[model samples]
Target: MRIISGKYAKRNLFTLKSQKTRPTSDKVKESLFNSLGQFFAGGQVLDLYGGSGALGIEAVSRGCDHAVLNDVSRAAVAIIKKNVALTKEADRFDVTNMPAKVALKVLAQKGRKFDLVFLDPPYAKQQMVKDMTAMKQLDLLNDGALVVAETDDQTDLPAIAGFDLLKEHHLGKTLVRFYRKAAE
Candidate 1:
């Protein structure tokens, strides 16, 4: 769709026409950022299931300094590159085509730490808890980082040790959950 706010507000983006990926809707994206307060100061963002790179790009638009958009599909990664290029600040983005776990490990090896993370896997393939645990173990999250999880309403994410449930928003069939990592 398009960016809802910030520098790229209302800018149209590219999306995959495949049924394999679902882009977050503008309404849900708005509500999601609203819960975190409008724009951010500066931070790193990660979208492991980078469908069209929309979520990560949106975060950059809303003040995050950098974003890493990773997808298992090369096609999605290509679209992610195209969308990031549209920002005209290509240096702000890093696109990788790999399995989510591999990307996480690679980022960890590179000593990357993120302030914001978006976990919006395919509705039926959600593994948020496991993913969060991996991130925690990989030391990829900054203290007090925020993790936004978008899933089908049927998916209920439980409380993990290092994170506190911040809020939840139910928008029709979709459920968005926010969690803050406990400072170590």
Candidate 2:
């Protein structure tokens, strides 16, 4: 798949060949960003389940200052690095090869707070709610931070306190859910 919009719009990205990884298509990515926001001014983004770093890189191309991309698979992480390299702005990104939990902890320790987060974990093994909860406890989310979850049609995201459900869009069998953290 490739970036649909932003500075990296039309740029191609690399994805793993394994069936375990499901890369978001250009059409769905377009719909997802359109619903969230066409672009951003300056903010940090987190791609917690980064398969190829496309979402994070797209955020940077759209004006976000920085992005942190993480994945558990080594091959996926390598592909993410390659994709980020294509942007020619690698300094705008931090690539981490680690499990989501470890990545979150490390980012928290570094005092990283994100304005946007993308969660597209495997549909069969989802821990999105738990991940978001940890983000809250670790104080990794900025006030009003936006979290987007891309999942299969069968997956239904439950309501969580302190977050407002902003939008939901269905592109074929893909389900996209948007949420905004409440400010204290």
Candidate 3:
């Protein structure tokens, strides 16, 4: 896969060889970023269920200040690290090898917050609502923070209480939804 825009536009990224991780396609990634304003002025990003670190790295490429990429698989983490190193801005990334929930708790303990978040767990094992709820309880989202969820069309995500569904798009078999956390 490759970065779609910003400083690292068109830069190639490495993905895991295993079927355990699925990298976002270039078309879908480009469209998603375009929907989210293409680039950012400055903001922190969290990439949970990080696969190859493409989503988070793309955020940094598009002007987000920093990104924390987390995945449960060692192979995926290794691939993510390699991809981050390719950016030559490794300092802007924090790679964590852990389950999504565990990583969120650790980040919360550190009082970390994010202006953007990408949640793309395995389609069959998506717990997006539960995860978003954890983020809310941990106060990990900044006011108006954007949460992007990638799932299959068959999986329907309901209107979450603390988040407003801003947009939804269907790309092939993939469904992308953007939610804005209420400014509290």
Candidate 4:
């Protein structure tokens, strides 16, 4: 796969040939970034259930200061490391081989708050619900932070309390839902 824009535009990245890993499509990534506008610049991002580390890497390419990537699979972590190295972004990222909740707890303990968080877990796992819930409970999100969730077009995300749904884009079978934290 390739980075769609920003400093790393058209740059080639690494990916693993595993059934569990599904990289976000270029079209979807492009659309998501375009909508992000200036929000991605100089932000801290979290890529939960990160597959190829594509989303976080893209954020860094667009000027995000740093990204923390978490995945439960060892293979996914390895691929994310390879992709980060391929983009020469090893210094801008961290990879955790653990479930989303575990990673969330660790980040919260570290007092880390992200400006943007990407969630694209396996659709059937109903991971969006659990991850968002944990994020809210842990208060890991920054005020006015953005959350991007990619899921099968059919999956319905819960109406999270602290977040306001910003936009929803349906690109064929995949749906990208954008949300922003509500003012306190």
Candidate 5:
């Protein structure tokens, strides 16, 4: 897959050969960035369950200051690194070779905060609710940060705890939901 817009628009990104990783479709990514509008400038982003690092790289290409991509599989992480290098954005990204929850815990402990966060876990895991809960517990989210969750249309998304539902879009079989952290 490749970046659909921004400075890296039409740029190629590497992919994992394994069947375990599922990359987001171009149509879905297009709809996502469209919905995000011009909010990416100088933003810090976190991409959980990042497959090809498309989402994070797209954010950076659109002016996000930096991005952290996390995935459980070594192959996925390797592909993310390669993709970043291919896009000439290696300096704008960090690759975390670990599961979502573990990466969130580590980042949170380091007091890391992001302006945008993307989550696209394996649909078979039914991991939406559990992951959301873990994010809240680890305080990985920041006030007003936008979290985009891409899941199978059938996957149930939980009621966001510290965030408010901003919008939801359905792109064929993919469901993209946006949430913003609530202000105290």
Candidate 6:
């Protein structure tokens, strides 16, 4: 896979060959970024199910200040680190090898907050709503934070109380939903 735009545009990224991780396709990534304004002025990003760190890295390339990429697998973590190194901006990234929930709690403890978040957990074990709720409880999301969730078309993600659906699109079998947290 490769970064779609910004400073790191066209940079190559390696993905695990294992079936455990499903990397976002270039088409979806590009379209998603376009929908999110293509670039950021300055803000942090959280790639909760980071995989190869494509989503978070892309955000950084497009101008977000920093990114934290977290995944549960060692192989995925290694791939993320390699991809971050490829950008030659390793200082702008933080990689964690842990479950999504655990990583969220740790970030919350550090008073970390994000302006953007990418959630692409394994389709078989999707817990997006639960995770979003936890993020809300932990105050890990900045007011009006944007959240993008990629999942199978069969999955229907509802608009929770604190978040409003911004956009929803389907690219073949993949469904992408963008939500904006209420500015409280």
lDDT of 6: 0.92
lDDT of 2 by residue, 16-68 (tens): 99998999988888888888778999999999999988889988888899999
Which of the two candidates, 4 or 6, achieves a greater TM-score against the reference?
6
- Scored against the true structure, residue 138 in model 2 reaches a CA lDDT of 93
Candidate 2 TM-score to native = 0.96
| lDDT-best of 4 and 6 | 6
lDDT of 5 at 120: 85
The parts of candidate 1 lying over 4 Å away from their true place are: 123-126
Alpha-carbon runs more than 4 Å astray in model 4: none
Compared with the true structure, what per-residue lDDT tens digits does model 1 show for residues 12-131? 998898999988998988888888888999999999999899989989998999999999999999999999988999999999999988999999999999999999876433478778
What range of 10 consecutive residues in model 6 has the weakest lDDT sum?
121-130
Error of 1 at 173 (Å): 0.6
lDDT of 6 by residue, 76-163 (tens): 9999999999999899999999888899999999999999999998853248888888899999999889989999899876667678
Clashing pairs in 2: none
Per-residue lDDT for 110-139 in model 5, tens only? 999888989888863357667776777777
Summing lDDT over every window of 10 consecutive residues in candidate 3, give the lowest-scoring window.
121-130
How well is each residue in 8-36 modelled by candidate 3, as lDDT tens digits? Answer: 88889998998877789998999999999
- Alpha carbon lDDT at 79, candidate 2: 98
Question: Could you give candidate 4's per-residue lDDT for residues 89-181 as a string of tens digits?
Answer: 588899899888789999999999999999998763367777887888899998999999988888887788778999999988988999998
Instruction: Give each prediction's root-mean-square deviation over alpha carbons.
Output: 1.3, 1.2, 1.1, 1.5, 1.6, 1.2
Instruction: Give TM per candidate.
Output: 0.96, 0.96, 0.97, 0.94, 0.93, 0.97
Flag the better candidate by lDDT, 2 or 6: 6
Instruction: Name the Cα RMSD for model 4.
Output: 1.5
Query: Candidate 1 — what's its lDDT?
Result: 0.89
Clashes found in each candidate (C-alpha, N, C closer than 3 A): 0, 0, 0, 0, 0, 0
lDDT of 1 at 107: 98
Where does candidate 1 clash, by residue pair? none
